[model samples]
Target: MHILMVSHFFESHLGGIERVAGHLSRQMIAQGAELTWAASAQDRAPVDIPALALPCVNPTEKLTGLPMPIPGPGGMAALWRAVGRCDAVVVHDALYVTSILALVMARMRGRRVVLIQHIAGIPFASSVMRWVMGLANAMVTRPMLWAADRLVFISDTVRRDLIGDPARRDYALLFNGVDGEVFTHIGPAAQRLPEGKRRVLFVGRFVEKKGLSILRAAAAMRPDISFLLAGAGPIRPASWGLANVHDLGPQKPAQLAALYRSADCLLLPSVGEGYPLVIQEAMACGLPVICGAPTDRADPEAGQFLRGVPVDLSDPDGSAARVVAMLDAPCLTLPERAQMAAWAAGRYSWAAMARAIMGLMAG
Candidate 1:
């Protein structure tokens, strides 16, 4: 089936939703589906897929803060045109204005519109920002939901949140998959730590929602373990004086692979998430994960690689203790690690994610 995937950001800016969209688009193309992607010109060109760039709706007005547009003219028209040419349109991240426009236009065209929601909660912002966001969502979300032929959520928790009521059954859960081969090549986890120090890796944006402060406090509490923070954002510099932590900035896929290879475990204390692609990536590298429990029901298949640890954002000391426990636990053996890696390879493959999305499209 011909599909048009609309996202506000793409490969140039590496985020979870952007990565999911890029991965799905590539897989769909491999399966002989015609795919066209639309995103803001502010984003860099996507990997392997040709994309139509729309003008940045809300241009990044500040250098130090987040770069996002408010919604512009050309972007709306490009979205409409992209969706018009395809048999169906999949809108990733419903909160984005571009996705909302595509949803409305696709419905108007009588084409199937699938909304992919990545997060379960809205950002906790200032009263004014919260009000604006709530108003914007109210204006756009209902129409998008009505227009969508199907709603695909990355996790069961996200699906439930989007539907709001247990009685409402309008969405399906599609778990994010990983590229097994890329991670399988990470070789065995290094037996010896560099300089005999336990290396803990944190991958994701430096945002409050990611529980960066919790991670910082945790690192400070455990001066023995060395920490490597990957990815760029507002929170990176804020983590400044902790001698044990090293902010490697953002790394390319290869660099990330190396980081995973050298690390003992992946540390993610996110306050919100649908499904973190980094978890799969870490598992692919044969590294066990210690993450905040997803509010969604656990996936039975994923139990082996993940240890659901409790994180109290308000209590940094308690959160640090959790991280310390993870760090002190017995490391997974080579054989055990291999099993986790294989599980990730088998369960989270791009092909599998694409097939799940295709099933939604067909339904």
Candidate 2:
């Protein structure tokens, strides 16, 4: 089957959805399915695929994050040509203009379009900002979702919150997957840590919704612990102003994998997320998590191997206290951690995800 993958950003972008789109595209090709990709021409990711780079302007300063004008006049013919040739068009997010355009074009060509929802709405710091997003989604994206041939929700939270009763068919809960084998431990020799100092790693862009304020407060409250923050975006970790926190900047997949294997634990207190690929990578690396954002996929059976800890997102001080308490609490032994990694490797492999998606795409 021929599948066309459409997204605003691809491998060059450092978001969960972008990374998954890259994975899904590669897997589709590996599984003998013909694949084509469409994204902002400005995205200069080194991906080996038949990708149509459409013209777009990234309005980073805009309140609406998904405001990239997809398939400008010069790119319309290219996008439509791709749609006409594909059996199915798999668009990443329902709300992005790029995705919306792809959906419309695919529908025009009598092609099936699968809309994979990363999250229902964008994450915001203020109630006002979130309110704007809600209004736009209700008016714009909901109609497209209903029109889609297949609806794939990344997390149960999104499904329950956004879609109370889906008047759609062929819907599935598709959790993000990663290559666990790449993130697994090497022999007995592990990275040695300083005496009595456990490494707590936080991975994600330094954005408002990533719970940066909470993480900063938590890092300050617990001076006894060492925290390493990974990822780079518009925000910077230096603004947090804590000595215990060190910025690792953006990481390549291999570097991130090594860090996961070496770290004592993963701690992300983000306000919005479906099932992060980072959490799955941490589980595959046999590292336990202390995430404030919990979903159904946060469970061990769901391949995240989540060791959830409750913390008030509104109160960073409370989140810090919870971090300290979780550290003080008992953790899994080496053998158990190994078992967790094994289970995650089996359940959340990219190969498995590709197979499931193929089944969904098959009309």
Candidate 3:
């Protein structure tokens, strides 16, 4: 089958959406499907899957955090030309302009459309903006849900929270994966930290909904633990004014794997996520994860993982106390770490996820 994947941005960017989309596309190609990617003109795919770069610009950090494609008349014309020849269209997002255009073009061409959503809804800073985005999601999502032949959600939590049930008869909760071979253990993790300090790693964009602000207070509360933030975005982690916090900027997979191996644990207090690849990656690297509970947030699948604690970020001091207590607790032993990695390896992987998505395609 010929699959055209519509992504807002591919390479030259570091985010869950880009990485998950790229990994799945490669797996699709490996599964005997001819996959072509349509993304921002500046973006490129790491693998052999061909990329069609459309005109894009650096706008404010809204929506996806990455730069968005300027799906102008020319861009839409380009997408139409590309879609005219594809067998099936898999759009990674339902909110982006490129995705909207891809869905419309696919419908017009009588092609099957599969819409993949990594998030339940758009998170905003203000209540007014949140309400506006909620309204937009409702208005836009309805048609796409009706038009698409099938829908793919990254996590069961998101599927339940966003649409209530899978009664639509054409949806699946295919979780993302991490490269266990790469995120392998590298000796003792305590050795990578300061003299007597435990290392706590946070890997995600420094955005509002990510809940990095709470990490600042937690770091100050527990100066014995070394906090390393491994991402870049609108808000710099070091700027939060925690002397114990170290900014590692953005790291490549190999470097990230080493960090995971050496770090005592992974901490991500983010909300509004459909399961994060970083969580899977940290687990694969054999690091226990301490993340936000997805009770109200998307990512309930995360609640199943071990070697971690789930804390509600609503109460700043309470959340900090959880981290403080966890820090004082013993880190995961080698056997426990191996068990954690194996659990993630056995259940989630790119090949498995791609096959599940492909299963949704009409034969």
Best by lDDT: 2
Mark the 10 consecutive residues where model 2 has the least summed lDDT. 60-69
Local accuracy of candidate 1 as per-residue lDDT tens digits, 15-84? 7788888989999999989898888777687757978888875543244233355457766776777777
lDDT of each: 0.74, 0.76, 0.75
Q: How close is every model to the real structure, measured as TM-score?
A: 0.87, 0.90, 0.89
Candidate that would win on TM-score:
2
* Local lDDT at 63 for model 3: 52
By TM-score, the better pick of 1 and 2 is 2
Model 1 has an lDDT value of 0.74
Please give the TM-score that candidate 1 achieves against the real structure.
Answer: 0.87
- Cα lDDT, model 1, residue 156: 66
Least accurate stretch of 10 residues (summed lDDT) in model 3? 295-304
Please give, for residues 9-50, the per-residue lDDT of candidate 3 as tens digits: 885577778888888888899998988988877555565778
Q: Summarize candidate 2's per-residue lDDT along 1-363 as a digit string, tens digits.
A: 999999887677677787899999898999999998888787675458878888877775344333354557777778888899999999987777788889999989899988888776655656776887799789877887788988887777676556765623447877778775477755232354555477888998776667777788878878878888889766667777777888899888778887888788888877656777888888778888777655434342653456566555466688777767877788778998898888777767677777887888895
